[model samples]
Target chain A: MRSVRYTPPLWRQWNLVWNFAQRDLKSKFKGSALGWAWSLIVPLATLGIYTVVFSFIFRAEPPDLGNGRDGVFVLFLFAGLTAWTFLASSINGGISGLIGTGALLKKIYFPPYAPVLGAVVAVGVQSLIELGLFLSVLLVLGNVGWSWLLVPVWAAVFTTFTVSLAVIFAVLNVTMRDLAHLVTIALQLLFYATPIIYPLTLVPEHWHSVPLRVLIEWTPFSQFIQVFRGLTYGLDAGSWMSWLTMVAWAALALGIAALVVRRRGGDLGEEL
Target chain B: MSEPAIRVEDLSKVFRLHTERRSSLKEIVVRGRSRRAGSFQALEGVSFEVPRGTTVGLIGHNGSGKSTLLKILAGVYRPTSGGVVVDGRVSALLELGAGFHGELTGRENIYLNGSILGMSRREIESSIQEIIAFAGIGEFIDSPVKVYSSGMYVRLGFAIAVTLDPEILIVDEIIAVGDEEFQRKCFDHLFRLRNQGTTIVLVTHSMGLAAELCDTAVWLDHGHVRAIGPAPEVISEYLGAVNENEALSNDEPGMIRAGLDAVRSGSGEVQVRAVEALDQLGRPLPVVLTNEPLTLRVHFDVKVPVRDVTIGIGFIHENGTGIGGSNTREHGVPIQLEPGVGYIDYTTDRLDLMPANWRMSTAVRSHGHVYDMLEKAFPLPVRSSGGSTEGGAVRIHGRWGAAVQEDSPSTAPSAATP
Candidate 1:
């Protein structure tokens, strides 16, 4: 089939994404009494447990570390968790969407990425709702402003990055079923490696030096959280260099994913 | 536009089957050492066009390229080399509920399935009430579809497709999804869609349905175009092929005699051929069924071993599921002497079944094994007409039961338990 002369309009694609997200949200809490309210209650309960453990049981005190950055500890946790959850939830479904829907692939063909795109958007929409609750907590304590813009910017970068990663996983998962298991391990490692519980400054000075700091700060994953942190504290996200890095990553990874899917999409249905 | 709805020129598909498939890691390691695998040519140089607002039937054997052609048109599989240009929007109900997400609720899935089939949300929103109403699954519409009975789910899905009303609709098979009533509803809905100027492409196993519904038919065999045009003509040829195959494998000596019992072949019923008994050594024996060693010894003159002679048999329970049988050529035994003369034999060493309608048939196989049949014996009735009938077909060897009271009320002179 020849690619149509008209480039695929975003609105049509976005509509598909919307329908999938609607189902994703409704399907998640479909049978329950509260339904989607579980999204709010589960996280709130997790926060209660964390507050009791760190603030009460341990009798820990907020560090007299720095300025506004030091006070936004809960925000840091939520910010990191928000981006991390998006990645985590997405990898689970996105990588396996094609594998899971082998029945449809054998019969009806659409863009191969349709399932992954829908699933990512579905999980992303759910995470945004969770993000809103965390943002409300921040508002109750103080004020939230420019950080919101950073959230969107980071979201754009993170989505592109995660989507690319998801595409690669999708393509690879069909041939190498091991990719799904490997992605799970990778998500686990990223959890502790990133500064979710503590500030980026909490790492000792020697540990954060030169290349080590550069590695952490320059990572696409780091940008996912860094931009959000920068927004919350009303700080700048480095210079044009970070934007250049993000754009380059999104372009390269996406290009690679498209190439893999296109070259191999023909035989994929048979294997699936 | 009055253009034909579907068009094809030299449409063909070739599928490659590797001798052995290797994992990605194995491929990387053995790179240049691996050899090319065997391939299969499923379809080649086949082409047909259905005029706008027409229904076309596709009939073929199980492995026929009918499905392959449909999939390419559905855009699921691209042809290895060839082209298919459809002039209007195409919707494939290749399988009922083919695209439904199990986790999604009935209401949410309606919107999803509707859009996937090309309905705008606004269109779906307007039809949503009608669709739910037609589906007849009241409050359960809000429940996840995972819990829906297959019949209910397919009904809802078919409702969405019919309501969408695309310019072209392709259905792989008729409504095998639901009960008879539901299937009739699907047919009625499809008939309505057909009248509304929507071109339909149908692939089905039922000749009656195809002949009644489709204006034209395309007969495919291992990807080759066997016949094209008029549904009745194409279906007739398809059935002819099926009858030929059945003839090659089904025959028996004196089998004609089996078709004629006094009860069935009475009066105007066809004449019964030689009936006798036999052994494994082509010798004679007697009394069959439930551990009696028995056989048939052929005897008689075939006024003519008519060009279309089919001798077949079947063991059936009252509820009707056929047990096995074999024939003359099937047993690798020959029919004797020539057209006007015949004497041969066969046997049933252990007739493992009990009493039931055991039907032995004789017919003229009209054609090869690709179609429904012509039965000369008219499904012969084999059950004992009277007292000899005692047990079920399974031969359970167990006693029957009855719950009768020993009240002796008459002896007590009209008694009521008060």
Candidate 2:
């Protein structure tokens, strides 16, 4: 009861988040016939459709790797989609995490951020499974490259931005439920606006649109996808400026989110 | 001598009461201008210290902020202005099984709930078997908790909480659920924990439990600490205040005041307007001692004249045990009824009764038919007059004596003492 800043110890906090993640994952597929196979089904189906449409029907040529493999547009698209799926689902999960667990939070007290962390962790694990499949296919085709080592680094940066946005959206959705729906729509918009499905080079050279270009360049999510692509397919190793911009954007989002949660976290129960 | 386990200084909590819930952005924007209706102050400037290794009871009526105070002590709510200092690991069961995820197995929830209550993984591992045993749901421990019954859920939750072995435990009527055996187990476990130097703060409505279990008691009324002292004294003061309030409300306008009559239900053919208990000297008394002469007067209004109407009066103890009674017809006294206000008195020379609160009732009948009955008219408190210590619903009047007689030949003494 003393006016002290009390928090559970670090290991225990991690355990709590992990326990919740396990519970969420288990319950997600508890009554299903195929169980965890469902996590792989959607992404794989998307990959199959994109491969048939972009490669066969459209006859769009993938960028030349200059190594052995040249025109596998599906592999390149899958690399970027893996990271996007991880970040997108994490952001979406993080946004609804607090509101989803509002019943438990109102009844008892634990660290408010644990649920957001748990949601991120659960989605992260699913994303890893997808990434493993992507890497296995790349290895089977004998196209393994040195640049793939940077996947973890890009993942670290991506997780930072995901956590910040998750915390922000999770807090907002507790008071404003419509924000959850808004965030889902916004994530869909962001997926298309960023260079996940199409290459950044597809932008016309003669276009002088400042806002559109800045949105593509300055957005943390855009940089995350670019960083992931640079590491996986070895097409674009972003310069120091792009790296700094991405790091700055992540730091800014995290700083703002921490401030918001600190100011509004105590009333989470009452608001609910 | 040591520092108290918890010291709360002027603790208060104010809650913003919105006239309508505003969970959406549209509501906030549309009705944003005229929002300042009012707020409710759940607790206001309440202060009490709980010493180490002692059980403190919080007694109050509903909506009296007892649960709010406990939540504040458990750090669930931040006080509006005041502060509290607690000196040990604190665990609170504010809502039983608050952390249980229904999708998880009972065993899994034990670990999850244990960590939520501030236990480490290793600590939960060590106590896992004990917790499972205490829960008593043997195979169901492996099954998801969503399938558990309400009793099983409460039992599992109480078992996990009590086995946490925290230095300080705060409970809010968590044992009020579950079956009687499980409730007894929880109470016994809490009592053992208190004996082992674990400071406990309990919020309960049962004054009997508070007086029997707690070392100190705090009575909360309207968000204020009304009284704080020994358990018996505080409980008595709380019960007295409650009774006084009930009596005042019963005497309010439009509420007919009839003697200990809590239930006024009938066809209303003959209405007993007012009932009173008086002494043999014609003095109305609310309370009388055992073996004291008393009279019960039933005042009624009859709609039509009736003949051979019998008036019966009976005494019932507070524990719902009925004592002996008599009616006018049984005593061969015939009574006539008329359409006017009238009174009938049943008198006793010496009221042989136990030391307890008794309720008096009256009935009107004619020719072995009851016209109307007034059940529980008025309460008469009967106190013992320093005699036998025997316990029962009735007091017996008798004398003890010893008589000697000649022993039979078969029963002659055989052994001798040196």
The candidate scoring highest on lDDT is 2
Please report how far candidate 2 places residue B204 from its true position, in Å: 1.5
**Model 2 native-contact share:** 0.46
Residues B1-418 of candidate 1: C-alpha lDDT, one tens digit per residue:
5667788778888777656665455564667433657677778988888898899988998999888888777777777777788877777778767778888878888988776666677888999999999889888898878889888888888778778777787787754566879877877877787888888988887666787778899999989898998887777777667645543554542133533332332221122355554445654332232444566553444443333333444445446666555555565443233355555454666555654445443321222421112233333223221122233454445676885555666545555556
Best model number under TM-score? 2
Write down the TM-score of every candidate. Answer: 0.72, 0.84
> Model 1 misses residue A241 by how many Å?
1.7
Best by DockQ: 2
Query: Which residue pairs in model 2 clash with each other?
Result: B259-B377, B259-B378, B260-B376, B260-B377, B260-B378, B261-B376, B261-B377
Model 2 Cα shift for residue A254 (angstroms): 2.2
Clashes of 2: 7
B276 Cα displacement, candidate 2 (Å): 4.1
- How far does residue B63 in candidate 1 sit from its true spot (Å)? 0.3
